[model samples]
Target: MCGIAGYIDYTGKAGDTELKKMTDALSYRGPDASGQEVFSLNNATLGLGHRRLSIIDLSPLGKQPMFTPDRSLSIIFNGEIYNYREIREELSAKGHAFISGSDTEVILHAYQQWGDECVKKFTGMFAFAIFDEEKQELFLSRDRAGVKPLYYYQHNGCFLFASELKAFFTYPGFEKAIDPQAFRLYVQYTFVPAPYTIFKHTWKLEPGCSMRVDLKSGNIAQQRYWDVLDYYGQPKQKIGDAEAKEALRQRLIKACEYRMVSDVPVGMFLSGGYDSSLVTALLQSGRSEKIKTFTIGFTDAKYNEAQHAAKVAAHLGTDHHELYCSFDDAKAIIPELPECYDEPFADSSAIPTMLVSRFARKQVTVALSADGGDELFAGYERHAALLGIAAKKDKIPAALRPLAATVLRNTPKTVLNKIFSGNTSADNLAKYLDFLQGKTDLADMIDFANQTAAPDTLAGLFTQAASPGVLFRKNEIRKLPGRLDQLLAFDYLSYLPGDILTKVDRATMHISLEGREPLLDHSLIEWIATLPDEMKYRNGVSKYLLRQIVHDYLPREIMERPKMGFSIPLVNWFRSDLRPLFDEHLSEKSLAAHGLLDHKQVAKLLHEYYSGDNYRFTLLWTLLMFQLWYKKWMQ
Candidate 1:
């Protein structure tokens, strides 16, 4: 893992001094060594900078901003190419000579052998930019799932790209104005989705995509090399339950083994969830020595899973470590979230994620994570909810459906919360019907399920001039066959990369530790995509096949339980220990100075939450994060 930053200056202002500042901004991502190269290409000059973490070849030969033997192409890359050794052999047979035992060399040769299509052959997380000296062109590509981050800004005939958004602030003529639509999106979704950053001048490069910039014309064009939708739409392959499960077991083992190939010591974050437990089991089984496992515990038992993680680690006979964080530990993290996420990210779980990363970095340089398992195998309860809504919503009489909706809407949320008791299935009739109210189709169901704030409610919080943060557009993804399949694809497209993957990338990168996701192997994702939703989820059970594989290693009693997702005690924390923090960052005075939100409306939400409107905790968190981010960046 490394950090990469570069720019294309048509007027020739980019130089080594400017590149050094931009690269050093990402030192937290890589602290071992740094390099920069600036080249004049006719009318334009190109600059590339890299901060090396040295996970693969711990030698000076592995230094980046590396060049081809003939010096025609230069490259700076961030991420591990797990299949680099295999590809290196192929490139060697093709008479591609290399001076370094680094994946950077393999990528350079592959680009020479495959041209712009080189990214198609890579099978790991990556975001890289290649500067072609002869063509005076810059080519950039991000991995298939966007596990690595890349952002760029283009305006006034200048183009700049970086591993983190902060690097762009080092550019000479950069501005820090917030994008209104993106701010609205952040308010609505608690996160601004891809291709949209907090700043109007910058954009995230979409995953599985590449862009080519022509220095001569200042023209840029983008192309998608791979997409999840293409694989989701393929005809389902025929396979039986036992065969499929066994195949998945072997494939996952191989994927885990591949991710374990690093010069540095590696470990896993054993969350004790189905995904993490399996990763730990497979990893320990393949290695002779015990692997390190990390977990974070919270004071609140309902939100803590460290005890379970301890059990999993003890059973697997691995080196286990756990850190129990107090309310103060989380509070200390809030002040840093603005600069850590580099954007307004409202995921409360990021607090624990960062704590865990900081803990693991003390022992290991590379840590394997179990993300993408949910998106790949229909693990979220919402997937089952989407299916249940279709099957159960029609059972309500059409004429009485409006009456039921009215009744459910009229009932106090406190009463509804009592009845559901936090369970989210058929037994939660009041909440289910409330969610189903006015829902016409699967799209409506999805929107209702995903809403952090109602479109109407969010519209009221902003001025009329602000465009509604469009969380998703109609044509963003093609319709899939099954409701679960469509939801999974939608998440893999938007929520997976935008929220989950982004959260992990930022959290792991924050502490300068490399995070690898074994389950995100594209081949495993494609094979799992061929299975029917029934195999993935059924009878109110989520990740059905995953449970079976984990059961082979763990007791069903330990692994099977209501999924307590990684979350914080938001309502209690805000009302008690964090009340002063809320006052400091989200006070009326702060909101007024920010000028993005209506001060009165923001105050009203806070007042209501204090008045026992418990559901407002989420919205309040979002508002607080935005205000905090504004204070950090806009101030």
Candidate 2:
């Protein structure tokens, strides 16, 4: 992976100093090397710069702002193409000569052979900008699932594109206004979705899409090349347990093998969970080399998974490294959050993710992650709960439905939490779902926002529930095998790419390390979508098929342990080491200065939580992240 930045100075010539500043700002993304290329078509108006991470080919020949043989196309790219070698061989037979062993060169040749259709031929994550010298157009594309990020700004017929939003600040004319609508969405969703960033003029290129800007006409066009909705209408197929398990095994092995193509050393973030263990086990089965693995443990035993990671590393006989994180480490990293995310991101797991990536980067340049497992398989507890709730709601008699809804509304949240804490899977699922559904009045939560955002903000909750993929149409007579399958599909479209992938991408890229997710392989995801839901979740267990496949390579003890997610001791930290810093950053005066929040309401949340009247850790964290982000980017 690498960092790419450039600008189309349609109003004037982009000088050397401007290009240097843009490229220099992104040096962390590609510490290996850097390159720049300027074109003076239409009176010296377009320039592109790239920072190289040097993963595929360490040779100088692979360095970019690489050009086609005919010199008609010049490109800057960030990401890896797992199928580059296969595509290169095909192009060579067709008389395309290659001067380097890098995937960037393969993309240059592929664009030459297929034109804009080249994106369809690619099967990896990427975000690239290609300047067509002859056509006088700048073409930009992001990968199918947005594994790579591309941010851009357009003002007065000039467009600047880069790997991170911070790069846009290099230009003197860039403004720092916060986009109010984006802030509203961020508060509702905990993330600002694509096509919208925190800044008003800046935007992220949506995944599986492309854009082209014509210099002559000063016009831009955006279009979608792929989407999950395309596959939504297809009929679900059934497979026996034995057949499904074997198919998943083969697909995962192939996915891992494809991602293993790299000139530099490759290791994994082995958290000792089912997801990472499965990837590590597959890599160990085929390779003769000692696979290097890294994990981070917290001082709090309840939050640490390092011991489990070490056990898996020992079983596989691979080189292993472990880092223990303390409350001080979490405090130290808090100040760096604004710079790392470049926007308001409330996922506190980003701290551990960054720690593991930094530790792994010390040992290897590329790291494999098992990120897509929960979304692809029926893993998260929410999926099972949503299914059960839908089933129960459907069975309620029409006459009593309104009364039941009223009763659910009147049920105190604390009482519901108590009722849902039993050992039974169904009870646990119900409790979690009830909490998420936030069945209680929004008046309480609304008071937590800066000010009560518009009532429309709560509409997002309904939109998520009634989203196109989440709920089937009432009249449609489709027979899905179970609720688990539906939940898996929903998460694959939303949570996986939106939250989990975003967390890993930002963390790893911050350290200039390339992190690849093999479990998110498109072929494997599509195949798994066809399997019966029971093959995924059986007897209240998650990742059932994955555990079975892992059993073939490692002992059952390692595969069957209790599930432990990558989490930090936030509740403890809030009451201790982070308290002072948190208070300073989220002071009521600081928030009121932004003029976006109600200081009184914000104070109530902080006061109630600190006094032990409520445990509003997640909500408070989200508010703290936004406050820090505002201080960095807006104020």
Candidate 3:
């Protein structure tokens, strides 16, 4: 619910002036108040800036860059600590005194009480920086699931950290060069995974991790404090279906109730999908007052879910609001993409997410989202696909597998598209077929499932292309027991934070609305991870266990609909409303000016896309996003 920016300057050039500019850029994230302070260290000048969104405490006492009573430690934080009251009680029992009800104050005391291990006690989404005045050290930590963003830069004896990349632009002597490997990663995954950003000498502090900077010696070290893998690797809980459902129901209620601990008005985004509906149902069941719910409807029926959301809202008797938008409304948001997402993010669904957040912000200051459900439970179609591929690939005749792969590789994309009937793109089919050519293992299945672009194809597009390490962490991932469990663990590690969580954070914070993910409570995920695989997904149904609990609150007919994920009509838009933007940003002149991508290859790709190669839409969109981001930040 805030924006934090700070730097450790050995050269002594950065101070309140630089801090103000950096924080000023993040005003939309926290417009209630702003704070900036400079601490003179033994060998460096530490500057911290904050933009307050005032979710937990609306009083002046909640203002940050808050300091300890003795002024030995000061901190700037950018998230909510849902369990602060519980932690406060624990700290108070330890003789720690508190003057304010703000979670920021609780964090300061928690750090004092437990030192580096304090993060282990927190149960919330947070990205914070604490400067130990006496120790002359800066400590930074991000929440376990990375629900909040924290980007940092380190080079030439200087260290800078911020909630958003835009703040880094305000720092003096900061370089803007793109990291070649990260660019390739973005091209391959349509998102650059953490521990890597688009720029060199900078990184997103990986989730469940913390860093300590030694101001005196200018040394920095990072360590992982928590990981979901440990839970996944544990033996399955020897619990029955009824017991598991009851246990999950209790945890779900607690998680939802915890997120309702804000001073400001709160609401939920009810997408009519299993995840959102379940969150809305659980929260509304516990309250006498109707919870405010918001949903975005598309005029295009194929992509619309507002009607279903209205049904869920009515069933729960909550206040409901829906915005039905046209292609024009969605297209208008295209130009703002670069500003909404500081990084080059290619999730087309982000457009609708931002629209919904903007809509919800009109009446509520905080909104609860059900994002981590898909990763925590087996809710994704790809999860089923991974399991299905592993179980069925061996059924194919060993001698004819190569022949089938050859036929698929040589088939015309248009023909393949017709055969698949647009259920999936020919590009993905091609990748699957290629995987079939080899001896399919769990690792190979995962690699194929995640392949966005083949390495050879990416090499042809960029002048300097190298594979990112995240793409092939297959060996480590295969250690998990079940195929579904392994895929879920991999996603929770990479895709959950890299794409889904990032989209929600930026889209919500862009308008100063605090977006909370209730489904991502670490304790809930850890317990769910120990359940048997069939309990999560069974008989061709995903989120089977979660659905059973949801059924207890609502009828089966109302909640048994297909999962139509939040998405946009990107291909049709490119053919009509977005054609001009595609031309303007991906123009040969623009590509030549960027001097990173091969203009000739881009031209060829565009030719193919316009010539009915619709599978290439994702690649084209990724390139367009990168081009737009480059113009906005790098130019």
lDDT per residue for candidate 2 within 589-611, as digits (tens), equals 78766777666666766786798
Best of the candidates, TM-score: 3
RMSD of 2: 5.1
**Candidate 3 Cα errors over 4 Å, as ranges:** 397-426, 470-473
Mark the regions of model 1 whose C-alpha exceeds 4 Å error after superposition: 397-440, 468-478
Q: Roughly what TM-score does model 2 have, to 2 decimal places?
A: 0.90
The digit string of per-residue lDDT tens for model 3 on 182-252 reads 98888778888888999999999999999999999988999999988889889999999999999999999
Give the true-structure RMSD of model 1: 2.6
| TM-score on alpha carbons, each prediction | 0.95, 0.90, 0.96
Q: RMSD, each candidate, Å?
A: 2.6, 5.1, 2.1
Which is superior by TM-score, 1 or 2? 1
